[model samples]
Target chain A: MQHYRRTEIIVGAFMLTGILAIGLLALQLGKVGGLGEKGYEITATFGDAGGVRNGGDVMLAGVVIGRIKRVTLVKSLKAKLTLEINNGIQLTTDAIASIRTKGIIGERYVRVSQGADEQFLQPGDEFDDTESAINIEDLISKYIFSSGSN
Target chain B: MNGVLNLFGFMGRGLLRTTERIGDGTMLCSRAIGHLFTPPWLGRQLVIQLYAIGFGSLIIIAITGAFTGMVLALQGYYTLAKFGSESLLGSAVALSIIRELGPVLGALMMTGRAGSSITAEIGIMRVTEQLDALEMMAVNPVRQVILPRIIATLIALPLLIAIFDVVGLGAGYLVGVNLLGVNAGAYIGETIAKVTMHDLLTGWVKSAVFGLLIGCICTFLGYRAVPTTEGVAQATTRAVVTASVSILIADYIITSFFL
Candidate 1:
């Protein structure tokens, strides 16, 4: 019984520690994405989502300001993404929503390039100026390989 | 012709035996799980098992996690620096550790460290007729022994994975920044900036599932130990092997499901 008691305490402590660690990680992730209160929601449509999944970061100027909330196909060809953007950061109607890679061939994230316009994008408004993710390798390969054939 | 016929006969028998064992193992797992929720829950035994599974395995997990991270960083820098894309190393290390290395390696390590012990301990009890004695006393062996171990494993595995992630990420940072001359602030900042809740959560879910499987495999193998001492040793070996293989196979299944 004593031996069992000792083992149980140790395992419980370890389990608790793990749960706490995950909690801390969640907090850090939240802080990084500016999740929770003070974030606004916006929607965008794209012909192709290009590996952009829900919870992918929404970046402004290469810095993450929000996260993707949900992704669904509005039509057979068009995909709609609901983004949670941080408060106080306004985006103009002309803002371009481009799916960008963090590094070369890295995970895909949505990047919003703020447009020079006075009209701020309201909640639930779809951004029309959107670009799908560019595969740099494909572009380069096409350029190098196709240029020779031509 | 006789020799070839003999070889084929041996192969067929071996295959049949393997299939029978797998079927029995599956049945045992179902029984254990079914028994788990049934009455006569041994809360005290559960606690003790948790301590053994969780606390006893920490140091090994930490060491492995840290070194794996450090090695990944070192290797990542060496490869990426050549292409002038050293900046990508942070994301590479973070994604690799979070997505694949963290859960799989952590579970594998635990399979060796904790799984073997669980098998041996249970095997010893079975051989000594302690399990039978409990049965004779009208105590539910599954509840008193196997349940605690299974519950402990399910609880402990994720904790080990969490420790691994933190330690591994930290070690990777150290190697990337201090040893490899990458910008410490940039690496840390990029990692924090890029990592999402989904990535971390997915890793945790995988670890938890793996933990449960490991616990089940080890405890089941241990519980099925025969009366002979040799059977106990064989059961221990089988537990370790089964747990490790299952962890790898499950990793693939979980990855496909999540990604």
Candidate 2:
């Protein structure tokens, strides 16, 4: 009976420890851009989202300031991306939204080019100047063939 | 002519014996599954097995996980920095550990730790006539001996994999952020942002299947031990080898299917 009790206690303790560890990790993940807190929302329409995925970072001047909240098709050929920008950073009405690659063959992220216009973008405003990410493989293939033609 | 025929006959008998052993092992696994759900469940036995398999194995798993993470971070930093793309470090380390390393390595470690011990204990019991004694007493040995180990293994393996994932990721962070002076917040943030539910779910699923394989193989090998101490020792060794090979093969199959 004592041996059985000891076994139960040990198993309980081990399971409790595992649960606690996972819980702590989940909490940490939730705090930083996972749950999308304290960020202003904006929209961008693009001919293609390219390889952009939800949870990809939104960057300004090479610094991550927010994340892609959701992606949906606003038209048959146009995709709409909802971005949650970090608070305290205001964007102009003329700000350009472009998809950029971090490294060669790396994942894609949204890059917001700040505009010089004095007018601040209101909530739910959409950026008109958007650039889809350039596919390097496609570019390389095109370059090789096009250069041969020339 | 007679000697040549005898040689062919010997080869055929050997093949037949091997096939018979495999069939018997399969039948044993099926019956063990049936016995697992039937009445008079051995909760106490299962709890003891769980402690032995789970709690006792934590320190080794943690150490191995941490070392693996540190190495991944170090190597990843060197490789990515060469291309001036060190920011992808988090995705590389987290995806590799969570998707592949954590489940497979943790299962292999448990195969060495818990798998060998379970096989030896049951093999010894078989040689000592304890199994026969239980059968004579009308107590189902499968229910008494096999079920607890199987249940404990299935429950314990997932927990072990989870521990490996968490410890390994933490180690990667320590090496990448503190030791190497990468931005701590960004490194962790990227990992969390990139890791999806599918990545974690796939690992846990693999762990569960590996657990079943280890338990069934070990128990089956042990229960069929020959009636001698030497035979019991041989069966125990065979159990570990067979379980390890099956884990590697199954991992490949699972990866191909999922990936």
Best by TM-score: 2
Instruction: Assess candidate 1 and give its lDDT.
Output: 0.83
Kindly list the per-residue Cα lDDT of model 2 for residues A79-134, writing each as its tens digit.
89999888888998999999888777677899999999999887788997999878
TM-score of chain B of 2: 0.92
The 10 consecutive residues of candidate 2 chain A with the worst lDDT sum are: A25-34
User: Model 1 reaches what TM-score against the true structure?
Assistant: 0.80
- Per-prediction DockQ comes to 0.40, 0.42
Q: Return the lDDT, model 1, position A8.
A: 57
TM-scores of the candidates, chain A only: 0.73, 0.79
lDDT of 2 at B173: 88
| Best-matching candidate per lDDT | 2
Q: Ten residues in a row with the worst lDDT in model 1 chain A?
A: A29-38
What CAPRI class is candidate 1?
A: acceptable
